[model samples]
Target: MSRIAILGEYDPTFEPHIATDRAIAHSSAQLGCEVEAEWISTPDCDRSKLATYAGIWVAPGSPYRAMEKLLDVIRYARENQIPCLGTCGGFQHMILEYARNVLGFQEAQSQENDPYASHLFISKLDCSLAGREMQLTFTKGSQIATIYGSLTAVERYYCNFGVNPDYVPQLKSQSLQITGSDSEGEVRVIELPGHPFFIGTLFVPQARSTVELPHPIVTAFLKTVL
Candidate 1:
């Protein structure tokens, strides 16, 4: 079976682990692949070592250390054309990594980290997204538009911060289209069109998925690799 690397941290879930695990595993099963969770501290990991996974999945967490490792992984994936999916903090870190490394914003940062990195792509939201609903708009000619077939809808969210409202314009101008958003049009999902698969969303798509009916995005992520 093909393998999908889940970049996870030493973390807990305000929700149940089984539910989250099932969401991911259910996606892998539908695509006939194996979902393997990779801890950031794994010994002997490197550029070449990372190439083994067909795709990568970033779970929700602090993403401090996991974010560093994911930066290297996503960079390699971006260059080599592998698939990746980042959800919640996973999504935040992906944007930060791309901004700091790929976009040459050396000090690009998240509110969770420095809180004043000058390029606040992430900031603590005025309200907790916990148990809240959101909507996102897919850009014309973008892959998400092709996937979801339209630009507007509601999604469940569980986050404190998102792509800072200010940087949304600059981010989209840089080919990182802010394809999705909340009802207020805040940035929600970001995507890179050129990559076979590289999409991150402020909402945790996995949480909304199930064995009987998995979410479209998560299923697409698995298909990207398989």
Candidate 2:
């Protein structure tokens, strides 16, 4: 059986984290593939050990114990084209990592982690989407659109922060494509072109997944790794 490493600070009490585990199981069963998913605390994340897993899932429950190390793991996956999925807080860090490493925004930071940082790439949303389900429109021809086989999707979120609108132009103009957006045109999902499977979403697709109805994104990710 293949193994996937879930890099995040585990908190059983957190709903999104719990949903993440279920989402993976649901996807595995739906795909008829036997796989193991191990929760790896962010502080224990190391590039040397990352090779042990077939893929990585940067899960929710942020304000992680070691943000820098978590970012390093994301960078490793992105650079190596490893199948990876990030949701909620995980999505926020993916943008931060991309801004700093790929877009030359070395000072870019998430407001959740650095409220007073000079360059805030990720900032709080005007209307928090915590515990809310919203419609998402995917960019045509993008990986997410292809996976879902449609231009629209309904997803759930448990986050208050997202990609700062101020930096959207730079991010989109560069390599990171804003593949999905909400009705108000806010970025809700992103995909890195040229990567085998690199996607992040402000909405936690895991929350909408079930054993009977596995979310397309999660199912697609597992299939990619398989």
Candidate 3:
């Protein structure tokens, strides 16, 4: 059985947190596979325990207790080629990890974590996306487009921040590609092409998942684990 370690501080009252667990079960049942998913609080996470999981999912609800610890695990996944999926706040921190570790932006940070930081790769959106359903377009030949089986999708969001527009151009390197965005060209999804499965979305795909119909993105992430 493949085990997935979800890195986030789980809250019972949080809809995204609850949906995340269900999404995993939905996908595992659909795949006819027995996969165990566990939530590891940010402060409790370390690379040793994380190394045992077949895949890593950095869940929503950011500004977690131990931000640096969370980023270290994300770095572990990226550097060691462990299949990883990030959504919402996870998306923001994933890019922050990439910026500081891969892009050589040692001072890069997320505004939510450090509002006064000098280099904020992730900043507050001009307008909040909370509880709003919006349309996003995927790069024609990107993995996201292939997984969704469409060039565009209407996804739901519960976030108030995203990749800073000022740093958008700097984020698209040879490995990290900006593959999905809103109609206005705001970055929403990013992918690491050669990794088994390394993708992050600004929208909460888990929120849209149901037992009868699992979200394709979550399903695809688990498929890579298998």
Candidate 4:
């Protein structure tokens, strides 16, 4: 049984379990996988690294720093073949990482970057919807296809940044499938099966979770490690 490590913050957004952390602790317990929860802003991470865990789960956070730290860890973990799952801001950083490292775009960056990146991997969103309905369509015969299939999917969003629409066509052309998106067709879920474990979602899939019925993405994420 591989242990699950949750990279989060002391704040509610990252460790928001009704201010109790129950939502998170419970979700991991249901998997029967030992969990090591760490606070991004504080020193709650064991060994100051995530190399010990079988998988990494990056939670939500405000003020990019919280997410910045989380992204750094995700990048490191992915390079090591440790399965990684990033939600919301975590997802944004994952895209940025792929663009910069995998896609060979060193200048790639997000809206949160100091000089700001002008690419589609990360950019300001065009709408003002919160937790609203977002439509997603999976690529045929892709790993995401096996996960959600060709049926259009729906997921909740609380993000204001997304993979630039202009870069969508290019990213898809590079084999980085647009696994899911909003009704307006904004990128939502992205996956690179070529890697051992790499998947990201613009929304917090864990938000609509429960012990009886865990989110397929979350379950699938854990499966990658097992």
Candidate 5:
């Protein structure tokens, strides 16, 4: 049985976290595979411990107990090419991790974590997306487009921050490609070009998943583990 480490401080009150669990279960059954998912608190995560799992799902609900530790896990997965998914707050940290570690922007910081940082790669959205659903247009020929089987998808969001527009050009010039965007062309999903399954979305696809209709991205992420 393959095991997946869900990295986050599990909170019963968080609906997206709950949805993440259900989505994984639904995807597992659909794939005809038994996947054992364990929630690993961010503070207790380390590379050695994380290596035991076949994949990593950095769940929603951020401002984690140990931000550095969480980033360490993300960095480990990215560097080692481990299958990984990050949504909502996890998506924010994914941008931070890539900017600081891969793009050499050591000062890159999430405004939610450090509002006064010199370089705020992740900033508050002009309009909060909490409890809202929106349409996302996938980049043609991108991984997200292939998974969704269409150029457009309707996704859910519970986030208030996203990649700073000022840094979008710089980020796009790097290896990370903005694979999905909104009608206004704002980034909503990103994928690492050569990685096996490294993708992050500002929208929480898990929330829209069900036994009858499992989200394609969640299924795609699990498929990489198999």
Candidate 6:
């Protein structure tokens, strides 16, 4: 059986965390494959164990116990071509890892972690998106659009922070692309163009997944590793 490492502290009461586990099961069933998904606390994450997993899911619920460790894991996955899926807080860290390592913004930070940082690539959204479902349009021909088989989708958001608009232009590169946006054009999703599978979403797609129909995003992610 293939294994998947869920990177984050797991909370039984957190809806996203629970949904994340269930989403993986639903996808594996849909794909007719057996998968072992393990939740590894951020502070306990080690690259040696991480390399053994077929893929990694950077789970939500942040202000993680070990932020630097979380970022390092992301960097390892990005450089190694490991299929990676990040959502909500996971999405924020993905941008942070890229900014600090790839874009040379070593001081870049998430405003949630530091409101007065020198550079905040991730800032609190003007209006909270918790308990809300919103529509997002995917970039034509992008990986997300192709996976969902559509140009638009409505996903649930349990987050209050997102990628800062001021830094959006800097995030666009040959490899990393902003592939999905809300009606107002606020960035909602990003994907690595050439990697086997590397995607992040400000909204929690796992929350919308169901037993009868697992989310295409999660299914697509599992497909890469399986």
lDDT of 6: 0.94
> What TM-score does prediction 3 earn?
0.98
Q: Please, what is the TM-score per model?
A: 0.87, 0.98, 0.98, 0.79, 0.98, 0.98
Judged by lDDT relative to the true structure, which candidate is superior, 4 or 6? 6
- lDDT of each structure? 0.73, 0.91, 0.93, 0.64, 0.91, 0.94
Going through the candidates in order, what is the number of backbone clashes in each? 2, 0, 0, 1, 0, 0
Q: In model 3, how large is the Cα lDDT of residue 203?
A: 97
Residue 162's lDDT in candidate 2: 89
Q: What is the number of residue pairs that collide in model 3?
A: 0
16 in model 4: Cα distance from truth in Å? 5.4
**What lDDT score goes with residue 27 in model 4?**
50
Pick the lDDT winner.
6
Candidate 1 versus truth, CA RMSD in Å, comes to 2.5
Report the poorest 10 consecutive residues by lDDT, candidate 3.
166-175
Q: Which stretches of candidate 6 lie over 4 Å from their true place?
A: none
lDDT of 5 by residue, 1-226 (tens): 9999999999888899899999999999999999999999998989999767989999989778898899989999999999999999888899999999988899899888899999899999999999989988998999999999999989889999998999998898889999999888888999998999999999999999999998899999999998
Candidate 6 TM-score, true structure as reference: 0.98
Q: What digit string (tens of lDDT, one per residue) describes model 1 on residues 1-226?
A: 6666666553555462344567768877777667675544422335677766888776676535645656777677777888988888778888887887767887778888787677787888988897787666767777777777677656777778777777766676677777776667777878887889999888877777878877778788878878
Q: Which is better, 1 or 5, measured by lDDT? A: 5
- Candidate 2 residue-wise lDDT, 9-74, digit = tens: 888999998998899899999999998999999889999997779899999888889999999999
Count backbone clashes in candidate 5. Answer: 0
**Model 6, C-alpha of 153: deviation from truth (Å):** 0.5
For model 6, residues 78-196, the per-residue Cα lDDT tens digits are: 99999999999999999999999999999999999999999999999999999999999999999999999999999999999999999988998546999999999999999998899
Per-residue lDDT of 25-124 in model 4, one digit per residue for the tens? 4555666765554444413544355655777766655335444455557667767777877777777777776777667776677775643545546777
